[model samples]
Target: MLVLGIESSCDETGIALYCTRRGLLAHALHTQMAMHAEYGGVVPELASRDHIRRLVPLTQSCLKDAGADFADIDAVAYTQGPGLGGALLAGASYANALAFALDKPVLPLHHLEGHLLSPLLTDEGVDFPFVALLVSGGHTQFMAVHGVGDYVLLGETVDDAAGEAFDKTAKLLGLPYPGGAKLSELAELGTPDAYRFPRPMLHSGDLNMSFSGLKTAVLTAVEKARAEHGGSLPESVRNDICRAFQDAVADVLAAKAAAALRQTGLRTLVVAGGVGANRQLRQRLCALTIGKEAVQTFFPPPALCTDNGAMMAFAGAMRLRHGVQAAAPAGAFTVRPRWPLAQLSP
Candidate 1:
């Protein structure tokens, strides 16, 4: 089956084509990071407008790269919810209209489910019945995956997600917008012991975690450093803070992932979402083990870690392959900007 996927959940507009027999044919993406950076963060109105501008060209580009045409697409799949209402609508309306035009069925996929299932796109070894650690800018949670469309929430953040904390902390240290990745880059140059930050909910005896407290701790440390440096933080000191902050987040995630594995007796861990691309987090997860058995960890390629059309396309194809019913094309449709992953039915 040939499935075309559209992703406009947030600041990125992604489009792709996937074939059940041939895997991912091609994908195209346009990120609004540069534009949003000027505003210190994503402005939803701008993001929605950009999606409208990019979707058609990107879809054409993807089709050209795949050597396919609109008539060849067997189904249309798109992110339906759990994102900016406008952004989701941009993709959803396009997908539904396209599907209606082609007389193809539409598969409205859950955004987080795309992230959770992304690893399967490349890793042939990862099977069903695994634990998933979804750490992204908007969310951080652990889920027990039994199969496609079968997910159980294991635990999640009580407050800010790990990636949000990273960005917020980076901003505190005078980094630019979209500061998470930059903070990580500077962390590589940091001294490990130069600073220490609290690891919130590390031993709360449950899978739930928290990072808001950690962000506050970083703020406190930054204030102290600025005071000592005569109201200016030294570059070296900033790097040190970055390292400590990254280390703390990595530790918390690694520990909770291990705990989830222990609780579920599932040794396979699939890490997805943007923060899953963190080199430090990857290193820790790669080396993680529970008791005597080493855990097998899987990550989507770095490019796929963020919101993208490839994951959405791949996810939609998987659903059709697995027997999930696709909605017939219709004139009217609605989007759920706050849909919960747990509410998805098999």
Candidate 2:
């Protein structure tokens, strides 16, 4: 079966083609980061417009790279939501229109599910019944995965997500837009223990987390440093703060992941979403030993770590392989701005 996936849940427009027998044939992505950078954040209107401009060309690019024709695509899959409504609509409309044109069935997939299942695209040896730590710009949660469409909510953030905190904290430290990656890079130059940020809810006796307070703590520290440094923070001081912040987040996530594994009695841990690409987090997880057994962690490739269509394509193919049928022909389609991953059933 061949599934063409379209992702426009947010600022990125991703298109891909996946063949069940051949794995991912090809994928193309166009991030609106540079455009949104000027605004210090994404503007929904701009994002939606960019998706309109990129989707068709990107899909064509994917087909060209795969050496496949539109007739070869058997199904069309798109992110059904948990994102900007306008952006979601762009992808949904395009996907449904394409499916209708090709007389192919449409599959409305949950965006988070796409991210959760992405690691499987590369690690073919990974089986079901694993623990998943999904941390991204808008979501931070732990889930127990029994199989495709079978996910149980383990825990989630009670406040700001880890990625949100990273971006907000970076902004507070005078970093540019899309600050999370820059913050992480600066952290590498920081001296160990020069600064130590709070690890919020690291021991609340549950899987739920809190990072909003951590961002406030960073603000407080930044204010103090500015006041002490005559209203200007030194470069070294900023780097140390970034390092402290990253360390705290890494420590909290790594500890919670280990706990989740122990609680579920699962040794295989899959990390997904943009924040899952954190080098420090990956390193910490790789070193984790749950109880006496070492934990095995899996992550999608760097390109797949962020929002992309290939995950949706691969996930759709998996569902099809599991006997889940695509949507019947319809006159109109809608997208979900907020949908729970647990709502999907096997």
Off by over 4 Å in 2: 325-327
For candidate 1, the per-residue lDDT at 302 reads 98
Model 1, 59-115: lDDT tens digits are 999999999999999989899989999999999999998888888889888999999
- State residue 188's C-alpha deviation in candidate 2, in Å: 0.4
Q: What lDDT does each candidate get?
A: 0.93, 0.92
Instruction: Report the lDDT of model 2 for residue 262.
Output: 85
Best by lDDT: 1
Model 2 lDDT tens row, 162-264: 9999999999999999999999999999987898878888999899998998888889999999999999999999999999999999999988998899899
Q: Residue 259 deviation, candidate 2, in Å?
A: 1.0
lDDT of model number 1? 0.93
- Pick out the ten consecutive residues of candidate 1 with the lowest summed lDDT: 323-332
TM of each candidate vs. truth: 0.99, 0.98
Which residue pairs clash within candidate 2? none
